[model samples]
Target chain A: MFRDITIGQYLPGESFIHRLDPRTKILSVLFFMVGIFGLKHLYSYLFVLALTLTVILVARIPLGYLLKGLKPIFIILIFTVGLHLFLTPGQILVEIGPLSITLEGIMKASFMALRLIFLVLFASLLTLTTAPMSLTDGLEKLLAPFAKVGLPAHELAMMMSIALRFIPTLIDETDKIMKAQKARGADFESGNIWQRAKSMIPILVPLFVSAFRRADELAMAMEARCYRGSEGRTRMKQLVYRKTDLIVTLGMGSAMVAAFFFL
Target chain B: MIKIDNVIHTYKKHSDEEVQALCGISLDIQEGEFLVIIGHNGSGKSTLAKHLNTLLIPSEGQVLIDGLDSTDPDMVWNIRSRVGMVFQNPDNQLIATTVEDDVAFGCENLGIESGEIRARVDDALATVGMAGFGNKEPHYLSGGQKQRVAIAGVIAMRPKYLVLDEPTAMLDPRGRQEVMETIHRLNKEEGLTIVHITHYMEEASQADRVVVMEDGKIVAQGCPREIFSQVKLLKSLRMDVPPMTELASILNEAGLEVDKTLLTVEEMVDALC
Candidate 1:
């Protein structure tokens, strides 16, 4: 159930998109985002929409899962549309209670809303296809050059991976702690917002204490394994780009660029 | 061989008050032998294990892994690589999400090449009887499997001496049994020197040597039969003997003809017949 929080979660599959190198997927997403932000005409938006849908279809991610990921951002989407529709000054289309809707406002709001939706879709699509480990590996390699600039590329990547690894563990621990507190007649539900907030303290205290203890033990175990830092480390999984990865990444990048500049 | 020479560790509790965790302790862990350390909590069983791998430096004295001193700044990694440690909790030790990656963690940290790391990971996984579970996530594993994975992670470093500190303490009975068998197999089949620490006397009874600790000192050291035969002394130190040994002691006290040195259920069965 904890894993069913589909936002930024991987859906294991053997689709064409899923098999692509994580670096390829990440770069394509970046290219599409840049193209989307620069597009001016409506046809380009339509082109980008069709291409996103095609990519998602190739990725074979269920429509329901993508929609679920967008649920948390629905309010933000609506707010963006509303603010642009009412606050922009232009040739008036309608007015209600000191708020005027204009022709330019209508165009602006639609584009803004479409932009937000496309951003969410592409971002979730990236995470949906790539396993968290692969994503972090790709990131570490991509960021490796920045190490000389004092970036700590490997450390950052390691932190990201370790954070992902512990998510399920922490969720289970939180569940256990909550149940233990509830068994002691501690109420977590059927309370006011403030009361519910207060009820969480009992769970938080023990969770923090145990998490710190785990951290201490983990550090010692790591030291025992001869882990000093990322200075001389080598990974088991190497990110290699295949023929399909190259073709797909190039195709997607150029298509987005074409849509943005020539559509 | 791992040699601990007069290791005295004084742990700072709030800086002002200090508790001596390991008091002038010296022990020789010979090559290819199964040695188990049994003690109650705060009896410095873990502290002694930690000293083996340089996780805790001796306040005064020395620890040497195959003639490399743990106190030497340059030899820390060498000492650690020679004496790999597996801690009590399996959940906390695995840094990678997947089993194979976690196994390769130590090898990677040691700067082994990619091909060599892969080979070692595969070999380690097979040795732990977890070859097919390389792709499995850590959270999906049972407690025993996780501990085995942790063991795999340690052995992937190619350590000669394995030090486990209460590895089965957090496991269920089945999990504990799985871990015990795995360690025993590693000790017997691979001829790896193992220094295990546990409070479970049953587990200790199978070791080549048993070291009993009390108040930060090794009070007794001998073979399992010899160690378990002194039931009253062990009981006085708040330690338990194996069930069969305890039964033998009880039966002997009742004027029955039973050997007090019995360590296993089969032995008890034979003596009863």
Candidate 2:
């Protein structure tokens, strides 16, 4: 059940987007999100949407697989579009019972849905193309300048990588705990919200205990291999910006600029 | 060489109870020797394994990796890099998502250049029989594969000595055999001193020397033949002898002419036929 998470999952490939440097993708995604939020026109979003779809096509990510990631967010999409459809203050275009469907309402609802869709697509695109460790490494390099003001950038990156490493292990552990609790007649499902939350206490307590124990053991193991906190560390896969990264960055910048002015 | 000079390790529990985990444990580990340590639970075997790499400094004694003092704070990383450690839990010891990244963790910590780290990571992965598994994640690998990756991680640093604390305790028979074979190759081909801690008698029988621990002290230390010959004493110390050794002892008890110290199936077949 926990494997249903598709946000952080990577679809390994040898496509152009995959070959782009992780730092370029991470930075571009950040700017893209900010830029998308600032756009005010439908046509402006259409341009960005077309660009994102083209990138996804270049990345060779199957549409079916990409849309599978939106399953969990479908309800939120429906709620946002539904609220905007009837509550948007605009001229009425059609009458259905007391709820009048206006042209402006239709446009606003579609805009909201499009923004949400774009948000998820861009986020997933970044994750789909970049490996989690590469992403963390890019973040570390980007955040390195802040280390002078006591940012603990290396520590943060180390923690993120470790967390990424343990994600599967912890998920398996949770599944085991849930199974064991079920075997002992513990009802996790078929309960009210409060009851379900309370039922998680048993699983959480053991998970936390095992997590702390794992943390302690992992710390010792790291120390045994002479891990002294990234002070003098060097990566085997060094992050180097290639010509592809430069072109990708420039193209993305110009596209965002065009979208902003064209609106 | 590891000179564990009368190392006495003491730690206080959360209840404020002072526990003496190691009691003046001194053993001279020669360079390029495969030494197996066996004991029951809480026998200071793990505590001693931790000392070889300076994971835990001796509370009242000294552990010297080569000639450097492990207790000296400045030399901890130096000592550790020279004496790498692989712990029992395969899931916990891995520090990176991918096998190559985890293997390079040690070399990265040592600040080796990117080019050299890449070479060493590939070499280390190949040495552990995990060459093509560089891009694989830890969870996708079997228990043996994960443990081998952990071994690869340590060997990437090119340590002179490798200390393993119950590395096979969590593996199945096949997985355990895989790890044992890899370790034997490391000791023979790479010429790395091996300090292996395990309760498995078969693994101990393959060691060049066996050190038995009990109640925070070394109870016996000798060749596998000498250690397993005293089956009664080992059993009394809550240790299992190799199956062949036990069978040979039974044959000896039943008025048969058999060497009670025989530790392998071939030896038993020779004795019987």
- Model 1 alpha-carbon miss at residue A222, Å: 1.9
Candidate 1's clash total is: 0
B149-255 per-residue lDDT for model 2 (tens digits): 99999998999999999999999999999999999999999999999999988798889999999989999999999999898899899778888888888888899
Please list all clashing residue pairs in model 1, or write none if there are none.
none
- Cα lDDT tens digits, model 1, A22-107, are 98988888888887877887667888878889988998888887888888788998998999999999899898989999989888
In candidate 1, residue A50 scores what lDDT?
A: 87
lDDT per residue (tens digit) for residues A32-115 in model 2: 876776788877877786888899899999998898888888999999998989888789988889898888899989988998
Docking class of 1: high
Candidate 1 positional error at B130, Å: 1.2
Indicate the residue-level lDDT of A162 in model 1: 86
What's model 2's lDDT at B93? 93
Q: Find the 10 residues in a row with the least total lDDT in model 2 chain B.
A: B53-62
